[model samples]
Target: MIDTLLILHLNDSHSRIFPFGPWTNDNKRFYPSVIRFAYITDSLKSLYPKHLFFHAGDYSSGDFPFNTSVGKIDLKILKLLGVSAIALGNHEFDAGPDSLYNALLSENIYLLSANMDTTSHPLKTRIRPYEIFNISSKKICVLGLTTTEFNDINPYQKPIKFKDPIQIAQIYQDTFNNLNCYLKIILSHLGAYVDTLLAKSTNYHLIIGGHSHTRIDTIWKVKNSNNDTTYIVQAYEHFKVVGKILWNLTNNKLIDYKLIDVLNSPNISQYMIDTLNNIKSQIYARFGNVYDDSIKSLDNPISNSPDSIGCLDIPTGNLVADAMRFQTNADFAVIETDVLVYPLYKGKVTSDDIFQVMPYGFDNQNAYNSRIYKITMKGSDMYNVLGFAQLIRGSVPIVQVSG
Candidate 1:
């Protein structure tokens, strides 16, 4: 067996494929993550021919690219980065299970979710509990487990059950023992706390984790049932950092590790530069250049505050409420302050800019946007809702009203 093994891990990189921040591309920024990852991966692969690259999960949403391509380009980008496999994230089923299944199949996306039932779900027989790799005379087994929260959040993924992760992990431990793998690792989407629980119970050497977007630069060590040490690591979200690991398999010791920032790289290959440039072009070609997708210019900014229309506040939420009222001709329109994510600022407003103002509440029918509901209630019930709004009892204030 080889003395050492190298690995790179990523998680919750929610489709922010391009340089993050303003509309313009800042090549200097560590973002435009695809290129940075490409440069980094190429450098590492050349030095160490045998290595494993993994993503803990959540490569699905959180960007225009995901909405535009229905998650095809997102998967393509990961495959382009030479990712061996990805753990199934909650957001993967955001567009409904059928769409997810088709996207994964069309892109040939490999996934792992040990606790999920493959037979009940549409992705029957495709995904596995773990993957075993024989690299450089050493066999390494990698098990995967997503969180139970996935079931709670994703209503569209029906008939799918999340089994107890600890139980599943132990079952996979037996698999590793019987297969005679030299090293065992758990690629998890169950946040840091649950990962700690797994480490305490099971005998995996390493756990690369995601969910909760934790940035664990330093190794978190835990002693397992047999009192063997298990180390856990997580890279921060959105391709900001990568968990780099080098373990000495022969001695079963962690030799080196770090959470590498994408910006702190040494060299840039010409191939990576061209690939980076092409990313913008592809996005533009697929979805019209958002920069030029102008809606209209606003003479003055309309604030999206959920305050009384006659008061000092700009009543930005009222405009949405007014629109809703006019469309349905409701007696009154009521909404929450949270619905308006960004203020409609005064400027040459584009479609892209408007999307940012209310960029949430995605449903299974459309990953792009959400639908507004119109309901009927008696005056007494209406009084209760209005009272609740005025009091702001919950974390989110249910303000904004229109006649």
Candidate 2:
């Protein structure tokens, strides 16, 4: 029997095409990453002749150019790169249904989501619960499961309801059992913990997970009811890594699998390099000469001391609370200072500085009805909330202060 090699997954690429670092002047450009991925795909196409590419969702929203384009450019890029299917992430609704509809116009890729109810919307037919692909004459069932927390993150997604992911996974598991496919893969945007639970509880052969930006370099094996093993894999955020899974199958059953990080040693193809360079030039030309002057440093430095009139290092939590109060017209506000901004210094502030400080915005009219208040809570409650706040701040860094 011939062994089939399947190159598996990608997750949470927040439209980051350029690599910026802690202290590096040269931008390594995600074009190389793209090129490398393409080269790998081409190699797999030739070697296996049966390749399945799947993304765990979050194709756009976050970076400037991709967000500004409203996922149009991303769709085109992904189409060109040959994405077979993708799960619908919360960020997919960032620009609302219209943008998603536009992005899904092409039928080349399958946009799967078992949880989202789009019957009332125009994109009803575009999103599917699952898709089946035949590779190497083997039937592979692929189902998509999105996070139920879409209600909290996506305010723009109206008339759409999110179902319980676990329930949806069970439904798909039943379907897969009936189908008796060679393999069953669940493309999930429900984060790693949920994915692990799904892998343990359900009959999925493999769980490709995303949303938490976790990079699982090793294949996590979980035992099924019959003592069979299921594989789970997830790549880190950004376009930094591409995950490859080599599945060893025997008698149409998955025996074992190995996960590889293709990004570490990418073989950049010429075509990909050329395409990346063109994109790089276009991006540089578009914004290269534009000068932004909103950011300016104050000559009079504010002290961190409570008594200081002008404090450059005001707590970000305090500033965000104040900004929220002012913006929402709320009588009182509360925020953590660490999230607001870093301390400002030197002669001139730039647009980048302002962006760094005020990355997230508040536009809630309802907040106006409420007053901003700082409450003194018990140590236990404080500890819980503070710990939660710290975790959130770590994942999504925010700067509340301007100066």
Candidate 3:
């Protein structure tokens, strides 16, 4: 029997340490799910003894608690979980390069992104396009690809450039061919469609994806010359779930694999449950009073309500958009309410509401003044830019109304 290589995958966890009532009611059930994930990591480390861990991206700038910690707390958790390499998601740049660099340094994890140019930033040396991991006798070639749309969302941080993902993958593929690695995988933060397209064209055996926060368990078999099977997997956001990929490798070739969902299970470990509960209690103790007073229920529920078109406040949107318009001195300002939907509630709102809503901060004065307008693009460009947003909606399925 050939030795199996296990690659533990986690993605799109937008800082959800505890379950929301709207999402899942059983903290009894949810806490164990998290604990199970932690236990799995420890078990794999002992069982495989040659296991690797990879994260797709979007580690920061989503939920209120996560943004409040400025990614520091998340990094601590990831380090504790033993993440080896991670790709850069678009939200990773929400704080700009300096903040990201500082945070990355604190965690000291391998940051990979083939398309990103960190030369101008302090992370130039630390942030590489690809990294190779030698586990036992197997050479696992891993390449990272970030969304090029960073140019559109973060223009102020000039000098940072993104290469075409497919093109970069080709470069890494050629390098892998020369080195003759046991397995070739792409840690892609380029969304699902691009991962599919790249898998079809390349000889890669797996494409671990992020940016969409998709919960895909089945393997995506791409059609190509090599007839090589490409496995695509993503864990739904908020640390609510953990994705497990078990690969049976025989003489450097994958014979079989399995992707398991660690979140929605009935059986969970006691140790992990206790750890999670302790963390939650600490959080409540620090902010419980403030959250209770400020976090008021809505007169009407926004999600799943007949009166609600979507989970956004028309008045709040107008207020925020107008603020952008005034600050930028532009003809118009457009804000996507979906982008700031965190620390959210189905009822009355408060100060914590604003923090959760605008955790990324309104620092892009240039975006306001630059006359940002939405233009419909061809399917490909649109897929590249807005694809992740749609994917997130699909995975979480939060209803929002727009006028």
Candidate 4:
């Protein structure tokens, strides 16, 4: 009964539906688009009869697709991709729990969070702690864990507490005492740092993960409670790459593994193409002619990159601050580097390009831009705000200022 299972894993997709980079000539390895992601993943599944398409979390928010549709598009993509399961990500609650409930109600994918007490929330029925699947007559189980540190911004209501992930892992593993699943997995959204701690504490066959966007190109094999191998793997953000590992279900050993750069596959899903074409009209109606004639150009690329955002006033932040300050006719304008995404490269720029830069913020309509508001701040208040911003999230500049 020795069977090898292909674990096709992805995480922190963050709604990057579009592909980036020609990068190289082979074209077999581009940054990857949602369309190409579907194709490549579908191909892989066909190659392996027994497989699981696991998404760690953050299936929503970031980039154009989620910005325009507020997760509907991503949900559709996930449904089409036939995701086996996904752990809940912090971004899923960016718009609050009610919004998350509505999004989940519209999709039928299994979402899990073992430590979250959503029992009183509207999402109670939609979310669960673990799920069991019968693959080739063998029962496989997957449990989930999400990060509790949401920076005090998630607007969590009462009774919806997120418990300790490490504690929950211990408790949940014990609950499956009689099940004896062929494989036990912990799908985690607690970031690599926490995931490392979890791997050391539990004895699961694998820990597919998300949250920190850490690229575990090589599986981080840890010795768990039983002194056996517990492999941890997390793919990088967007659909740019994925990790596929062939694991022996019989011996509980990793047979082989490889990291695939998601490239545009010619054999695309026509249904997805049609769905994309349908989404185009909705986008056009929301933000008219986004890719129309370039309305502007740039001399140099302005990037508010996360790689080096240690409270430094990045060029992208500087440019956005200037625009915001000018538009509001205010004494000063401040924006966060975190809100800014993708860089504004040197060349002709379109509305769509800027959308990639800050593809968040919504109002009555899902595709609306973040409304710029003027707030009167005294000298002392400004100083305090800047001070707090500097250390809010590990010495990163949470705000960009223009005066």
Tens-digit per-residue lDDT, 1-403, candidate 2: 7576565578877655433212123423223345666676667667765667888998866444453356666666677667789898877776677667877774344589998865668776788998888766677888998888857655666657688888878887888888877788889999998887877778777888898888787778888544677778888876666777766554555443444454555476677667656665554454441123334555743322233444323443454556777776655555545333233333444433333343222122321111234455676775676577657766442233221
Global lDDT of each candidate: 0.75, 0.64, 0.65, 0.76
Point out the higher-scoring one by lDDT: 1 or 2. Answer: 1
Per residue, candidate 3 scores C-alpha lDDT tens digits across 1-403 of 7677878888776555433323234312223334556766676678877688888987766444454445666677777778888887777666566667777787675578887754656767668877788876778888989888767557534556787888878887888889987788999998888888888888888888988777776666776437856777766665666666667666665554455555545555566557556655655664463233445556643332222554334445555567666766665455665554543455545444444454453244331112345444565764454456656765342222222
Model 4, residue 84: what's the lDDT? 84
**Cα lDDT tens digits for candidate 4, 1-403:** 6687888888988877665432236533245467766778888899889898888998877655666767778888887787888898887765556767777888765589998864667787888899998876777899999898863544433345688999999988877656877788999999998887898988787899899888877778888988988888889888877678898877767898777876535566667667777877777776776654477877766666643644367777888899988888988888877788777766667676776677655543444556677877698888887887676665566777898
Q: Which prediction has the highest lDDT against the true structure?
A: 4
Instruction: Show how many residue pairs clash in every candidate, following the order shown.
Output: 2, 17, 13, 0
Clashes of 3: 13
**Residue 329, model 1: Cα distance from true site in angstroms:** 7.2
TM-score against truth, every candidate:
0.78, 0.72, 0.74, 0.89
Query: What is the TM-score (0 to 1) of candidate 2?
Result: 0.72
Model 1 regions lying over 4 Å from their true place = 22-30, 266-286, 291-367, 377-403
Arrange candidates by lDDT, descending: 4, 1, 3, 2
For all the candidates, what are their Cα RMSDs to the real structure?
5.2, 7.6, 7.4, 3.3
Scored by lDDT, model 2 comes in at 0.64
- Which segments of candidate 2 are over 4 A away from where they belong? 22-32, 106-109, 252-263, 277-403
Clashes of 1: 2
Quantify how close model 1 is to the true structure by its C-alpha RMSD in Å: 5.2
